[model samples]
Target: MRHYFSDIFLRKAVIALSGLLMLAGGAAAREFTVNTISDEKGNARTPVISDTGLVAWQAYSLHDGDTPVHQRVDVLSAPPNTRRSDIIIWQDGKTNNLTATDTRLTGRCEQPVVGGNAVAFLAWFKNETDLGMPFTLSIPDKTDEMKQMESDYPTLFDPPKPPPVSTVEAEAGEAAPPPEPETPEAAATNGLNENLQRQMWRDSGQAADIVYYNTARGQLERLTSGNRHYCSPVVSDAGVAFQCARGWPYGYEMVAWPASATNLVQLTTNYYYVLHPDLHGNELVFQGWDGNDYEIFRYRFDTGQMEQITNNSFDDTAPVVWDGRIAWVGYPTITAEIFYWADGALRKISERTEDNTAPSIWEGQVVWQAYDDTDMEIYYFNGRRTIKLTSNTWDDLAPQIRDGLITWMSYVDNWDSEIMAFDLSDNIAVQLTNNEFEDSYPQTAGGKIVWQTIGAEGSFIQMAVPAAAP
Candidate 1:
């Protein structure tokens, strides 16, 4: 019995020791040194890593004795463990070249050091009467000891191999293959034949406020010209409505043009500013500003009669009609509020604390831009309750809803503004543009979105198509 117990205890000890050995072997760390090829001038380069961890580099060459030469080189770095370095070269008044070299340099020390992982070596020479270009790098493999260390860690010094060349070809006597034909579904989805969102913007050109049209042709059409100052163009199947301002105090006269006619019919003779004209069936809902305040008004095309919808002393604007309700922005107090005209009664939707503007009604929900303690954000009211859509600290405004999706423009940072869309049902927001330029005032209709892109060339309308359903 004592011998059997000793045998069991020894087996247990052996099993515990083997488990610890395996754990230690798995935890052992690895060190690697990466080497890159130098240009013809013996200048090595470093690599650029993307957000996805992929690396890429371009090849460059040097000239020797007035003759051009070529060579292949690559930039490399460790996966994600250490700080990556960059190389920059300046010539004349501009940056002529930028590269990442294989040397790591220390601060406050100009001379190169031996046996350091990061060492920079600089070379300077004169060409004829001109001063030679100066080169600085960090990874100097000067001695055989450092060279042997690079050889032991082959991965660090291993250069990227060239892509394999293909030699397979079609037979000499074989006929060329026929081109593939397009499918009906693909043609319909990709073709520019469907109706898209159409809105107007003021171009700060000689033709101040031009009636801009965004169509299926993927281009903007300027309809009016020369000092007319046409603004606020809204389109429907029947026609387009606009406010043409000419003189002081920005006196605007409401006008409508049939889709087939070039001439516009002056709908209102008043010199007040009329804006935010939306067409529903044959009726038009717009906001007209007298010398004092703004009021929501409606016009019946068949009857040729204009009637005021809200007779309150507050400012009401941004009228959007959907599901037999006209949604607009009304300021009962100092804060801008949201109100909808339904069943011949006016009902307020948003809370009184926040200032709401740019209300759009679609699919039984009212979406608008509101400001709380922070910058502008988007909020939606579904008849019973209001919910904030975005929680970022930046400004997000100009909410437009179409086909069960809410599209808005958000400033991700001080310099980056993007167009984003959110599916109301699934509560999923998708970033559409990741550009550095400012993209704002996104309006969606049907399967497309149009926005104003503010870049170096000034503001212009840009369009984006929605992804097809999977």
Candidate 2:
């Protein structure tokens, strides 16, 4: 008889062995001190530290209190399997509760640890009035306790490393000549090496939200600048599409730019809000308000013609296309539904129970984010069946599917938001970021994932390439 081990069992066994070894070796317990700083209003901000020396602090919300809201400071540390304690260094002002009357503020925490490794940190905030602003978390570097944790817990770390160079043939008696340089055609054909061909979009130089090729070289390009606006950006082989408000009464309009350095083209001239533009072949599909209600629309690139795909009164958004099919989120009545258009007919992908959004089509599968009892989770559409990918009680959204992988942002209760990727073929969801800071809006293309992260000064984009398989 042969005994088989499941992946769960193997992972638990490895963790158990590592813990036993660490205890037997008597590894020195590391100590961490967490410090928080608020704008001016003495609002409390959460801060966290990982064993790898990664430190991150949350940014207070602008609706919580006043801009220069009160600033409070605290320190916390504990050893492994020991009780943690917190010390308040500074405290001021009574906590406010109301939303309209209350002033929102922003704050951050900065923690440092010795030894180069990745560290994980936890933070907590106090809001006497409304639910506090959605907390943000970050990790400064992959050092200290975080590094050790990654080494000991291989399942948790997914660091990207360069692909190995292949050895070339040479004359046995002749000196080995330098390897031939890659031709442009060969580089372009290899999707992973087409970083130089990728285009970027930004609003302005100082804007917070930016979208660009994660693996592309050169200076960080701004997609949109001026005012904290713009939500999501979708890029295809021909152009880049995003939501902007340059000439609209509302704060959003679907816009696109050619792959080359061409001017932006406003796809929708509607005065109402428009969002979530996706490209399929020669058509641009998006969701927008047609003066009365939200609906799906498609614009042809060559014909300069526009058509409505969905005419329902409820809101419909998050459109994706692949293999001559269109998948999107539709509000049939009260519940949000997933629908797909194929063979001159529209079919509901889900059973019209869960609220689904952020649909992406890849390799004949439709991937989306669905709401459950606790938080949002990822789901996959396979022709006639739907499968749940994650069961954690955390908010996960903005799933981007490409090349058999699904990447998204997940928010844990005690940890900052992280960029996680799952391989559909292997059924393994691996976390690619462990920072105490927030990492959200994950977009994957050509094996690389890019997202936005909040830091000490402002927000910036972070890119991670997938590690080549052994």
What are the per-residue Cα lDDT tens digits for candidate 2 across 1-470? 11111211111110111112233343322111111232322222332221222222233333332224223122122233222122111112111121112122112111211111211111112222233222122112444655676577443233332233333222334444456675655653545433332222212222223223211231222344334344455554454566765321234767665544434566665446777776654567888887677787877665667788877667777777765578988877777888888756888877534778778887568888888766787777766677776666667788878766677888854467876766554455566655577777765544545455654444443444433333
lDDT of 1 by residue, 378-460 (tens): 77776667777666678788888876667788787656777776654445566666557767766565444545554442233
Q: In model 1, where is the ten-residue run with the lowest total lDDT?
A: 107-116
In angstroms, how far off is 28's CA in candidate 2? 32
Off by over 4 Å in 2: 1-237, 240-274, 435-437, 452-470
In model 1, state the lDDT of residue 99: 25
Give me the candidate number with maximum lDDT.
1
